[model samples]
Structure formats: C-alpha cells, structure tokens
Target: MKQRGFSRRSFLQLTAGALGASLLAACGSSEASQPTQTGSGGGGAQPTTASGSPAPAVITGVTLRVVGTGVTLLEPIREQAEKDLGIKLEYDVNDGPAAQQKAATQPQSWDLYDQWFNSVKIVWGSGNAAPIDINRIQEWDKISPMPKEGKLTPEAKEGDGDAPYRILYVQPDNTLGSIPTEQISMLPLTFNVDSFGYRSDLVDEEDVDSWAILFNPKYKGKIGLYSDPSTGLMDLALGAQAAGLATFQNIGNMTREEIDTIMEILIEQKRAGQFRAFWNSFDESVNLMASGEVVVESMWSPAVTALQVRDVPVVYASPKEGYRGWYGGMMLNKNASDKVLDACYEYLNWWLNGWAGAVVARQGYYFCIPENVKRHLSQADWDYWYDGKPAAEDLLDPFGSVVAKAGSVRDGGDLVTRVSNIAVWNSVMDEHQYLVTKWNEFLAS
Candidate 1:
C-alpha cells in the first residue's frame, strides 16, 4: 500500500543534515558569521547618493540577520550595502532547505530570508513570511517584467527562470499568489535554468547531448548527483522520460506514484553501480569534476564556471529533454520588530538597485532588473552575457578574479535562448517529507 515499505519518514531523515549548499552552488562554510558596522553617512534614505531629497527613512545601527545560502552573502554586495545603505547585514548562510526549515519552524530565527522561489509553499506555509509593501521598494517599478510575466523579451512568453510569473507578487492578505498586488510576497532577485555538465574529453560529444546520457549504461558508475532532494529528484524524473525508464504527469510537480517510479529506477541504477558518489557541496562537485572521478553529473551553473576556470575541459550540456530550472528571491520575516522592519525594507530595495545582481551575474545568473545590473557592467559583458557575442576581454568575477578568457563566450548563449529551453522548475512538491525520506534511502542504498 505504501509502495514497498518505504515509510514516509524512513530515509528522508538523511536530509536532517541536508548537506547545506548555496542556491548558486558557491562554496560555503559549515557555519559563517560576519559583522556590519556603520560607515560615514548621513541619516537619509539615499545615504550613499548625493541626492538630498527625503524619500523614505532607513534605520541605522541594527544588524539584519539574513538566513541564506552563501551566494546570498556575496562579499561585494554585503560590503556595498554597509557602505551605501548604512545598515548592517549579518547572514546565517546554510543549506537552502535548512534555511527553509528554519523559516518554517523557527519564525524568529532571522529578520530576512534569501531562498529559491520554489520554497514559498514551505516558507509561507509555515506562516513566518511577512508581506513586503510594493510601495516601500523603490526599484519595484524598475524590475524587468520578465519576473512578473515570465517573458524575457516581448515575444517569448513561456518563462525565463522556472515560473517567475507564477510565484511572485503576494496577495493583499499577505499570502503568496500570482497576480501582482501592491504588496509582493517576496522581492524577486536572480535566477537561471540548469542542466548537467560533463568532461567533453571523456564522453563522446555526440552521445552527450541528451538527458539520457545521465542514465546511459556505457557511463555506468561514471556519473554523480547532487544530494538535494528537490532538484535531484526532478532531474531524475526528466532523465527517466529521456532514458525510456518512466514518465510523469508533471515533472515539476510529481505525484506520489510518479515519485515511486523514479525511486524504483534509481534503485535499479544503484544496483548496477551507475553512480560513483553524490555531491553534497559545490566544492565537492568541483573536486568530482576536476579529478574526473565522475565524468558527468547534475551540475549548477556556478560549479561549471568554477570547473572551466581550472582548465578542466568541462562543458555544460544542452539536453534534448530540456533543462531543470530554478529561481530565487528574498522574503521578509513576519516577526521582525518594527524598529528593524524599515531597515529590512531598505535592504530589500538595495537588492534591486543592481550591484548585487551584477555580482551574481558574473557567475551565470540573470537578475530581474537587467537594466540596473547592466549599468554596473561593461557593454562587453552585456554583449557576451545577453547578446550572445564573444567576450571582448578576459572576464573578471565579482572579486576581480579572471574567470573567463578573452574572446571566450558564455555557454548557454543569450538570456532568451537559455531560459526558453527550461523543461521544468525545481519544486518541493506536495509530498516533500515522504520524497526526502525516500531520497535518503536511495543515497544509502
């Protein structure tokens, strides 16, 4: 009755440790803490700017504890916020799901949150998420309509990152809903679609073009998977359809029966020694790719970038079955004190101002406000990242490290070309607890 004694809680307990990883797949510490101090600035909304107009008041002297993955704690963005906005940002960067769990269970653990848009059901379902007034965010109007309407350009309308038009915009009652209201449930940030990557030199380039390559018998024990219950499972679901092992009603929202089929196939593959190891951290993924232990694996964009920098000869694949996509945003904690609530609002506005978006975009993410971020970038960067042109010069990452060679090109091409191919969005699904348990079992097996 319960699908072969796979009790709901049995294996998913493996996720209690949950192998915390950033949404961007950047390397993060087990535990990291940073302090924000007041800088030389006046008491106005636009402290860093020369504008003397009094618009909205930003509170000073309180540290806003943000519970997020390491990508959300990008040092450049953090330092800029402290210097410009006159507010302190102290992030509790951990695994993505752990941040969700904390938001759900411990409502007051942090003042703000940085998470994937898919976690809305879990985070808001926990009733800890508070509404962010649309009026408070200065750049609200500046946000590209791509996030609200799921259209990167005027003609292409399916979506850029997952279901942006679906998950954003909170309802009047402070609940997550589709239609744009004066109050958005969360402030949309950066996102990108993802697919597996492999060592092009190791695998036949001709055979590496489909999701089926992940399950091909020839590469048995040569592949690895990220140990995330959500994205990993969705990728397996897509791979199943591609490999002719199974099908799903909706790969994005898999039913219990669909999940069982996926797990059964995974168990079969496990028995055949198809997997070498499961990656729990971005650094581990880099190690796996660089060392050539696992020739192909489910990979994040940033991980692929990291690998390419090491001269690993890795290429992120464009699967025929399409990509498993994901997006992220920041949310306000409902329990935040009024004293710090305004400060939180200021922080939210800062995210949309373009500096933060520019930082992550260097690692392959696209922001909701591309224009603002473009201001912080060169025409060469905009051309390479958006227009599909070759890089004009060696590209530097946010920290001034050369990550791209001169004349080099971004793999996924222009924004529209990449986002248009998304097959499914990452999701927690209806049976999160049960699937996590089953995932844990698969890992153990």
Candidate 2:
C-alpha cells in the first residue's frame, strides 16, 4: 500500500500553487538553460576568460570546509569545484551517523553541510544550519518538481515520510513548512529511488522480485544489510511485511511497539546467522558484494554500477512493492562569515551549473536541474539514463569504468516510471533516538 502525508486533492492543489510554473518550464526544453547573473554572492557568476574558456570567479582568501558522507564527497568533485569557483575546499567525509553528529553539534567545523533530506530535523533543531536564500540559487526555477512538489507529476504517488517539499521552505516563524518562501532549508541536489541488488549467478532473477526475498530462509547467512538505523529499519520493515511476519500502520513512523516487534525479529535472525554483515560505507558494500561474501543486500546505485564494471552478474532489483526514495542536498552552517557565505553560495551555484550534476548522473543519479545535465551528456547517454532506452554505446561511470554496455537498459526503466512507484522515503522518525538504541542492540545481538 502507498503511504501519504496529505490527501491527494490537497497535495495536488498545494504543489500546483507552489511549483507548477517551474515544472512546466523545466520539462518544456531539452536544451540547457544559461545561468542567470542576478542576486548577491555568486548567482550566475561564472565569468569567461578572454580566450573563450570558462573563467573562475573572483572569490579570494576563503576555503569552504564541507562535511558529508562518502556518497557525494569525491576527490574529483573537489578538484572540479576548486577549479570552477576559484576557491579551496576541504571535505570531512563520514558515515551517516557520524556526519549527522558533527553537523548537529559542531557548527564551527563546516561551512557547507552535504547530506540527505531526512537529517534536516536534527541539524535544524540544533540551530547549526542557516536557512538558504532561494534568491541566490541561480537555477532554482529549473529544478524538477520532485523535491519542490513531492512528485514529478500530479498523479504520481506521494511517498511516505519527509518528502523534501514538506520541509523545503522556511516559514515566517523560522520553521520548515510546505508554503513557498524566499528561504529554504536545503538546496536540492542529487537523488534517486533505492532497492536491493542481488547476484544473478546465485539467486534466480524471478525469485528475487520482492523485498520478502531478503527474509527467505533459502538465502539465510548469505544476505547483507545497511547499518544506518533510518534506512536500514525501513528496509527491514518492508521485508517483514512482505514476508508475512508483521504489518505496520505506517512504516516511516513506526510506534514503540512496532519498533520492538521489528527489533525482536531482527535479533532472532541475527542469532540464527541470517546475515553475513552490516555495511556502513559505500566501499564496504561494494567490497562485501565483490568478495562473494554477500549475495544480496540493500544497495545504493553506485555500488551496483561498480560491480557491473567488473562483469559481475549483479542486478539491481525493481521490487514489486516499489522503491524507497531519497534526496541529497546542501545546507549552510549558521556560523559562517559573510565572506565564507559568499564563497559557499558560489560553490552551491556551481553544483547546479550542470558540470557536477552530469558527473553524478553517470552513477545512476538524476539532478534537480535535468536540462543542464542534458547539456553535459551525449544524446545516447541521456536517452539511456533518462528515457529508459537501451544504451546505444558503452556508458561509463564518473571514474571511467564501463557500467552499461550496448543494448542494455536501466533496471527500473525511465525516470518517471521509477519514481512513480515509490512506496516510501527515508525518514527521521519521531522515535528516532529510541530506534537507534534498538538498532544498536540488534547489531550487538
């Protein structure tokens, strides 16, 4: 069953009122839109050199310190941003929990926060993150409706939990709300729907079409799971329900009893040796699958793509129950100096400028401003990734590894088809701290 925060009619009305114009304009063109040179602190500020090459901005004497998980923090991204923005960058990459801890308690440590939309509650509650001024976003109007309207089209399902639009705008009382405003809680960035990946050589493709397969006794001791409480719990609940073990009224916001019941089931499985390992990082997930220790697991897109590069027969499942959607974005720290803030804004605008978006799109992600990403990609690449068509030529990842070969189509089909089937979203539960406590217990068991 699909979960929702509001009725369908109210949702449509709210999104149409808030984001209809921008969505219509964005999808109207397949061509790239030029950056606008309006607003303060680096909106449309990429000046060209006299020789017809892109020139770096004039920001000087500032280094933007960014904190995020390994998913988005890459050496190549740092080098590209430094070259394009004329500023130095330092990345303190951590796993989900550690990154959130630092971001919530250590505001002095980072100028820009790069993480998922679910962590907005902890960081914003800590008062460490500042509201982003949407006026300074050079391509705000070109962003897709997914983050702003909670669905790409009015008829698409509104997935459960904190869909970015629910917490996107800054309200009059300095809280996040659905109403439109000049300031925002996070600057929308890369995002995609998520599901498990399985080895085609070990598991029959037909046998692994549902989340319940993860809990099947046939795969016991060969399965893997993510270690993060927020996402991992959702995966477990999905499997539990699909396996006919238990049902939750709302999987995203489980009650205390529901949490206990799920934890009990997990503990029983752990003691029975039903899992191989719990991965906490992208590299760990890749290594686990590559080394033949994990036949199946909850997976991110890049991990599946990386395995495909090695000729491993891994298939990212398009589960019958639907996908767990997520969004990643940039947030500002409250402790930034005006100079640093300008530099931060410059970096933020650079992310939406197509170059960075194109890089991540290579790894199975869709950018907010898809038109700009289209400019940086070849027609064949765009058709394969966005149109759900077969690859006309070999498609490579950001790091030059071939992920998809000629005649291969993306696993979930087109972008719209993939997102339209979302069953839930990654969320920060009301009982988040309690959930974490129980998750640790399950890990120990």
Candidate 3:
C-alpha cells in the first residue's frame, strides 16, 4: 500500500490481463520493484567561505546499500535522501520477516538496516549489527525520551515486551539494556500506535471498541489477522486476555504453557472459520477490507489511510484496552566498510532532517525528532497530525491523495495521547522458535 489506495472499484478498473502485474505492483513486495541506485555521481566536500555563506553540498561517491521493508524504503525517501545528502542509495526492499532475516544473517549484503526495535534482539544477537554512536547522530538529544527512558514523559505508561528503550542502549559489556549509554543498537526514527480498523457502516461501533473484537464470534467469518508471528501472537494474546479466554503473568514474555493455551484457542477459532483470511502484506489487508471481505482486522496507520483515500468507510479504532506500539530506526551493518558507514550516517542524518520526516508524517508516521519534522510541516498539518486538532482543510497523503475531509480530527487524539496509551509493543519471546512451530500448526488448522 505504499502509493496504492485501491478500492474494490479501483481493483476492478484494471483489465483482466493486467490484474497480476497490478496486484504485484500494489503490494510493493520484493518483486514489485528491483534494487536500484539513486543520486547523481560526485565526490568532494565544500568548506565554509570566509563570508559565512552556506557551504555547498558534500558529495561522497559512496553507494550505501540499505535493506528494509517498504514502510521506510519508499521512492520519495530514496530520491530525497540522494538529493539532500549527495550520496548514492541502493534500496533492497523486502517484507518484514524477509528483511529481518536478511539483516540478521547477511550483514555483508547491506550497509544499513532499517527496521523496528523488536528486531534488534535477533539482529544484534546474530552479531551482524554494529552499535550506533549517539555522539555521531546530530539530533540524538532532540529525540523524545520514550526511546531512552521507556516513557514519553515521566508519567506516561511504559508498555511491555521489548519496548524500544529496553533494547536501546549498548551496555559496557557489549549487550543491549535500558540504561543510558553513548552507543546504541538502533537510532530511533519513526513510530506509531496500532489498532484494528473496521467498516463503520457495516459494524456497530459500540461492539468493536476492544481487542476482543478479533475473538468475537459475531464477526467470525469477517475477521482478518496479520500473519507475522511476532505481531499476530501479540494481538491475539491481548484479545485472548480481554475476551476471558486466557491470561499470562507477563503478556510480553509468555510461558510455554501460556503459548500452548493461546495456540489451542487460535486453532479452535481457525477450525470454526472465525477468520476470513490471514494477510501478510499491506496490499492483502487493504484488499480484504476494501472488498468488504473482512469487516474488521488488525491494521496499520497507512493501511487505514489507504482505505480512506478509496472512500471506503473504514474507521481506525481506539481500543479501550489500548493500542499496540512499535518503533523503527536505522542500524549499521557490522560488515560495512568505513566509507560505506560514513555514507550510511549521512543518509541517517537526512532521515531526521525535515524533508524525509514530513514525507512520512503525511502518511501518519511520527519522526523521532519532532522539532525537525515540525519545521517541514505546515501549521494545519502539524495541528491535525500531531496536535490532534480538527483539520481546517482537506488533508492529502504524501502522494497527494485526499485522506481526510475538512473538520476531521485524527483518531486517538495527539501524539502524547496515543503513545501514552500503548498497552504493549511487538516482541520476540524467549520461546519464539517454539511459538513459531505452534503458529504454523494453527495456520495449517
């Protein structure tokens, strides 16, 4: 769903002959686009003039290869990064699991890895990720304390399960911990609170205000679920608890018995046809919802906006239980050359800079350095997106598609309201391998 907000009508508009290509392109998966280089060729740095005029662009003839999902590897970012930093960028975009697997096992393939904080454990454990020196990041201090202290403010509720701060800093013993340190696993960049999206016109809003909606027999054959083991289990766990089906001492780190219990419940639901489909890609989720096949499902911010752009009457729910949270950032590859690392740093700096942040902000992602992101956004944009104020005019996505009509207010209110309400974050459990085997059994059921 990178640039596609295809509705059922839009989906059918394509010729039958072109359906395969169209679907593939809309998915934005590895096959949708190939790895390509962007940026003009050049090399050299310009020193400041005696008159104090701005220095010219520094062109580093380095082609830093980056591996990540379509979430952050959009074309606009690649073009803008190259334009701003004067370094070539080769993006290898993969889906979530593929990207993480490549980052963990193939450090020699990429210079930088752009992924969520939850992935740091596996990538760092693989010894393929290098620690990011906070001293080198220009806006490190300007980032919000949530990624450093586990809370946006002192009073904010810090959710469990691999919170960004928990795996943030690099300890003196070369391990990741929450304690403050000069080095880190990943440089926090974008984050958002997630919840399910429902067809407002089809379902009663009152009946879908909790994660339990996913387990409700009322919507049995119309429910959708993400297929990723990490997030899908978390969402289900939350729902299972909310629905009085199960409980865990630590929802973040469930015991083997707890895993068995949840899997049993899921398998039972699957056998009963409680799920319409399990989608693994953004396009699949959007298609399922926009086609009215699934009335409610776990969804991302961009996916909701995509549905809105298609005029599908979908609503992003502010679940009473709270939202699922995730934060993403840049991690250097351990095998990158010094030159490649330097170029990677330049690209990283450009991400926190105003332009890239604003581009993503339009799609409902909040950058780490709000100050810089604010600079690049207009008053109305900042108010609607960050301040949670009513929109004075229609709001368009980064691709210039109208997503919100005038007077519309963002769901979940402002940034603080959303982040503070996070109930849990995506996680990699201690028994992740065992969990995977059971997850597969449920899928097969």
Model 2 lDDT-worst window of ten? 22-31
Order of models, best lDDT first: 2, 3, 1
lDDT of 1 by residue, 69-104 (tens): 877677777787776666788878877766776766
Pairs with steric clashes in candidate 3:
none
On TM-score, who's better, 1 or 2?
A: 2
Candidate 2 TM-score to native: 0.87
Best by lDDT: 2
Candidate 2: misplaced stretches above 4 Å?
Answer: 1-31, 41-58
User: Top model by TM-score, which number?
Assistant: 2
TM-score of each: 0.85, 0.87, 0.86
The superposed Cα distance between candidate 2 and the true structure at residue 44, in angstroms, equals 11
Model 1 TM-score, 2 decimals: 0.85
Model 3 Cα lDDT, one tens digit per residue, 342-400: 67666665565556777788889888878777767888899989999989898887778
What tens-digit string does per-residue lDDT give for candidate 2 at 304-384? 877887878788899888899999998999887677888888788778777777777888898888888888888888998
Error of 1 at 196 (Å): 0.7
Rank by TM-score (best first)? 2, 3, 1
Measured on C-alpha atoms, candidate 1 has an lDDT of: 0.72
Off by over 4 Å in 3: 1-59
Tell me the lDDT of candidate 3: 0.76
